[model samples]
Target chain A: MATVEYRNITKRFESFEVMRDLSLSIADGEFAVLLGASGCGKTTLLRMTAGLETVTAGDLLIDGLRVNEVPPRDRDIAMVFQNYALYPTMTVAENIAFSLEIRRVPKAERRRRAEEAAALVGLGEHLARYPRELSGGQRQRVAMARAMVREAKVFLFDEPLSNLDAKLRAQMRFEIRQLHDRLGTTTIYVTHDQIEAMTMADKIVLMRGGTIEQVGTPDELYDRPVSRFAADFIGSPAMNFVEGTVEANGNAPAFVAEGIHLALPVSLTVAPGSPVVCGIRPPDLVLNADGSIEGRLVLAEKTGPDVQLHLSVAGQDFIATASRDAAVEAGGLVRLSVAPDKLHLFDPQSGRRL
Target chain B: MTVHSASRRRLRIVAAWSVVALFVFPLYYWITTAFKNARDIFDQPPSVWAFDPTLKNFEEVFGISLGFLRQQEVLPGGGNFYMAPRLWDSIVVAFGSTVLSVTLATLAAYALSRFPFRGRHAFVAWVLSTRMMPPVAVAIPLFFIYKDVGLLDTYAGVILIHAVMNLPLAVLLMKSFFDDVPKEIDESAIIDGASRWLIFRRVVLPMAKGGIAATAVLCFIFSWTEFVFVLTLTQTGLKTVPVVSSSFVTSTGTAWGNMAALGVAAMVPAFVFILLVQKQLVRGLTLGSLKQ
Candidate 1:
């Protein structure tokens, strides 16, 4: 296991800059995920760490050694690609033993270690099968076994589970996390799926436009987002935003929109009448008989355990997850209550939390 | 299923057979001519069938008549009709050229496929453009060069020209085949501690094996049938089947039977090569499609 650090990494393709001044650190044995949408340079960052892509203007360190000029073969890392990339010409056993073969490991020992890695991924019975003969999940397992057999210093995953089905994705997520816990290899997984980031990362590095938006524990990002983008990107059903202005109701601060009013905490010292945006998560809003915030119900979507209440408050669309038993109608008034401090205030112009 | 559809299907089957017959009739006539006597070859209303078959032409061309059949005469080009050494020359030239062309093309094509060099597309187009020139124009210049180098009538001289002639087409085909294999497999191998050369040899090359076989077959066929370079460059030291086939048309009445006999004999090696790699030719075309 080794620490991976990117210092002032910049990437450009013929002057079209994809990243600028991007820096982050992944600690030894830490499962840090690079989370972002497509074309956000998350994959590029992961590739640079893997030595597949060059860092245009930065120093990349593995175990504190500068690797900007190192070739990928000498970097002591293993990767699982988005498509599983199992060598089509080889059987599972041969694919797993490829690293050992390249390093001149003994034939008997290579077979033994290959079997061990295959057993770890539940692919022991498929050692002789070619990749084309296997199902998607089995092919993914072979890919994992290939990576695991190397016992390299770092493990990089480029959205390895993105090609699997929904149910298989969840299972692979749990298995991958368990494997990391057991081996404790420094891993940098790039993915666009927030659920994978939140569920598997010890540290989630949320990137936007090639810059680090936030880097912290998943809970830290979800519980106390530092920006409006972070709050919306990290949650299910997304955070609801209602544009308005801050006003003072006596000593208590309140967010006043066109047809709605939300009381804010007294300690929120926004210049009494400045423009602001109020954000709250769907689950944080409770359906009650008495509430200070009122909205017109647009639609009620039932998702078995809970219903996502689609409401229009102050002519702004919002969603609140309420229990299925809550009496809600499509075209009726819905009163939603939220703790005063549960609401987040952001600067309307910069989208920064206030 | 329906009456009209059944009749239409029958009509299509007949049409396909007619086209196939148009293709195969040359082979049928050539093989029959190899066994026909000289008079029968030039018979009025040329004998498609019912002609008495003889091994006299084969004996005249191969210089080896079975004891049962022994009717022969002086060859039009020379005193004796022995031409086995010429067939040997053709074999060496075609096989040697195929090996040389395939080896050079594979390495060049791999670099073309993977490297991000400036003007790469233009370079590929330039390579293909060399093939558009008429072979005779290149052949005359090559003859003068071979004379200076003292390579005329040598197997190496002929093999070199054939290989050079085949290179442009071979490289283009091999490049397309290399492009079919996914680039991710190479990256995965590299990250697993494999050097670039190792990834190419152990991984990518095997994946493109079928494509290589297909390419080798094409090169072999081209070298086998080539005519102008051999005719322009060689004196009496060596001659390939195509050039030597013309020798049968000297002062004597055209030896159609002898020429047809050589044609029939020449088809064996090329036919055997196709039979050997036909499976790979089919597989290579479809190999890269499954991965992604």
Candidate 2:
């Protein structure tokens, strides 16, 4: 319901600078996910948004109001921490109703609002239970309920589902998206899991070394990553990269490395003799009889619908996702081809996309 | 091999029980001495078990039976044996100082746990160091201060010194307890719109009730048994049990029966206090110093 904007924010811990003059804006009602690996300053950004951490320089604005000095309570934001910081001594209803109780809400109204929030998170039957009596997923929902009960202008989640198991994490991701859809609260969720960002974010902000690498839609990040790091970080089974130098082969450019030769798109404008790293997603490489790249099969791991094919081409390890029904065998010869558009070429020196 | 291990286990049990009995033997002898006559107390080689029990010690020490008091051949100033006032003094000083010290320590500890003042660690070390000096080393200096302020021999004077003496250990215990309650909980409460004071009183304090009880019981015991301060500072105005128990060693030969009676009676309140907090005590002793 409120816009959150960080303008030229810089965070330094003593002498070590963690974030450097980073600026980003989150639109009202947009689910903005800050995605990065550990030690990447993602959680620090979320904590600053919640007012738990002070900004070392520059301004933080919520709904266009400068709030760098505002206390957490006055900021009017609710946060769901990575550890689901529920009050261990309080019942589920009490934890959900705590913010209202702090504001001196009447008992009857607090109960009504608490029950309503609990029901929305499917925790109505757990109203009287303490946090210790709940499972990890249930505790997570209680935390979510606690945040939503306040109806705050901005919702901040710091890796909220990282503790849950895989199945539960997926389900909670769906439920969180549903809740965002229903409440339309401006949410800034920090997570290192690319899948969470891909499935849940309206805007994905990929970060590295405390700076924004790219800010785009999930499809844009996965399909059109701006750098080699983005291309490698966002996809499952990971994108495979082969080091080579591009050479002119008539109109097209051929990438040549030790015992490896592959073609680049005709439109690739990188100087034909320049060194570059060519990348391709696992799903983009398809099995074709007349494929240009050939390698000996290593391992075919079937994951229900698709098989993750691990192959050794020349001296490098490569992975491709093959259809489960495709005729494939371990240690057999495999040939795979990629569409020219699916190939991503990055500058070898700067790692920038070519 | 199994038989050898079983016999070894039996020997371990016997050794453990022997140590326990060694500790409990003195207490058993003292309790039985409270019920013995003057003659039985001085019996040849001392009576371990067989003794004709009598209530004369309790009756005389507590002034329980007026008819019995009338039967005794007494000196004109016979108030020396009446120790009910000294028992009352011990209870008042112990309870008073425990309440005072625990209140101050809890407030100081919460601030220590949450605030980031410069040299905060050094400040805590300084607080604890106050208790490191020998009690006798401070007793005489304290006596002069109490006398100069006209507080000597008063309940307020003794209560103040005892509370000051116990504050160091009390603060250390309470501060550690506060540290054990995760700071994340406080941050969460703050985000929930509760002020620091509200979060402390409503959230942190209730969670640390077990630790506070443990600290209060320790303070109560220290105040109850403190000797040199009461002995050095007070005279006719007041006397607690530990110092007053020495009065039974007058030149007219020790009144072993009456002294044993007073010792047994004075231990009840402290024993009852320990029993009341026993559950919390166990948990508090292992409090978050170790990972769960």
Candidate 3:
């Protein structure tokens, strides 16, 4: 395992810049995730670290050694691509043993190591099978096994789990986490899926427009996102934002929209009647017996476990998660009370948290 | 009893059978004619089966004296003949040309398929344009150049011309095959510690076996039957089987029996060649190109 440092790495494709001034350090054996939407330079950053892509200008150091000019293989990094990139012509055994074979490992040792790697990924029975014969999950496991046999200093994953189904993805996610824990290899996983980042990463690096937006633990990002993008992107049924003015009545501040007013925490220091965006998680807004903010239910989606209601008030729509017992139908009036501490306030024009 | 469904099924069956019959009938005719003597060949009503079959044609051609000794007919009466040395020369030239052309073209094709460089589109267009020209158009100029360069009446001249003529087609076909190999595989190999050459040999070439076989079959067939270039470029020393077969067509008594024997002999190598790579040919033709 090794620590990787990307210092002011910038990548340009002709005139368009894919990544710019990106700098971050992944500590030894840390499960770090680079998270962003598609075309947001997460994959580009990962490839740059793998030395598969040239850095237009910057320094990439692995284990405190400058490897800016070192090729991927010499840098001792193994990458599991999104499609798995298993050699379709090779069987499971050969696919896993390819890196070792290139490194000139003896036949007996290669076979022994390949079988062990296959068993680690629960693929011991599939040594003779070709990649085409394996299912999607099995193919992904073979890709992981291929990387494992290399025993490289750094492991890079470029959205490896995005191709599997929901259940299989979750299952594989656990297997990958367990494997990482067992192997203790420094891993850099890139994914656009927030859930994968949240569930898999020890430290999550949120990126937007080729720059690091925020870097923190999953809880830290969820609890206190530095920007509106982070707050909205980090959660499912994302935090609803209402554009309104913040009104301070003595010590308590209230956020006023067209037809609703939500009280804010005393920690928010916005001037009276200053334009602000109020952020609230769907689950945090409780459907109470008596409450202040009122709206008519626009739509409700029942997920069997819980029902999510889309409440429309004052030209803004708010999402509220409630139990299945609360049968709020469309066009029905609903009242929700917001806990003041759970509320997030942002500057309206800049989207920066206040 | 839907009229549309019934008619569509009927149309499809008719179209499919028509294609099969169109291809099968010519080969059936060639095989039957290969067995016939001079009179049986031009029978007003062509017979599908030979009334009397004989192995006289094969024996006569194989036993023809090169006039080194007193002329002795290998059969009761002379039917066909071939000088052993010249027949071997034709085989050598055809196989040599195919091997050289296909190997060089494979390298060129791989480069065109992978690299993004300046003037790439122009280079591809230029290669394709070479194939558009009629072989006969360059025949006169090539003959003169070969004579001036002391390449006249030699196997080297014939092989070089064949390689040049077939290079465009081979490059186009092999390039399409190489394009089907994913660029991601190359990148993955690079990250796994493989150099560019290593990636080509270990990853790209193995995947392109089907296409390589298909290209080899096509190049062999083209060089095997190429008459115009062999006729014009080389006079005495480098004549191929096609030119030799055409020599049997004299103005006086036509040597139909000898021609049929020679035709059969020429067809054997091509038949064996196709049989060896028939799987690739069927797949290549049906698929239009390799799957990516």
How well does candidate 1 score on lDDT at residue A96? Answer: 96
Model 3 residue A55 lDDT? 88
Q: What are the per-model DockQ values?
A: 0.50, 0.41, 0.38
The DockQ-based CAPRI class assigned to model 1 is: medium
Two-chain complex of model 3, DockQ on C-alpha atoms against the true structure: 0.38
What order do you get sorting by lDDT, best first? 2, 1, 3
lDDT, candidate 1, residue A253? 84
Candidates' TM-scores? 0.94, 0.92, 0.91
Highest-DockQ candidate: 1
TM-score of 2: 0.92
Q: For candidate 1, what is the interface RMSD?
A: 2.6
- Candidate 2 docking band: acceptable
Task: Write candidate 3's Cα lDDT for A164-270 as tens digits.
Answer: 89999999999999999999999999999999999999999999999999999999899999999999899998998888898888898898888878788887778
> Model 3 residue B150 lDDT?
94
What's the lDDT of the predicted structure labeled candidate 2? 0.89
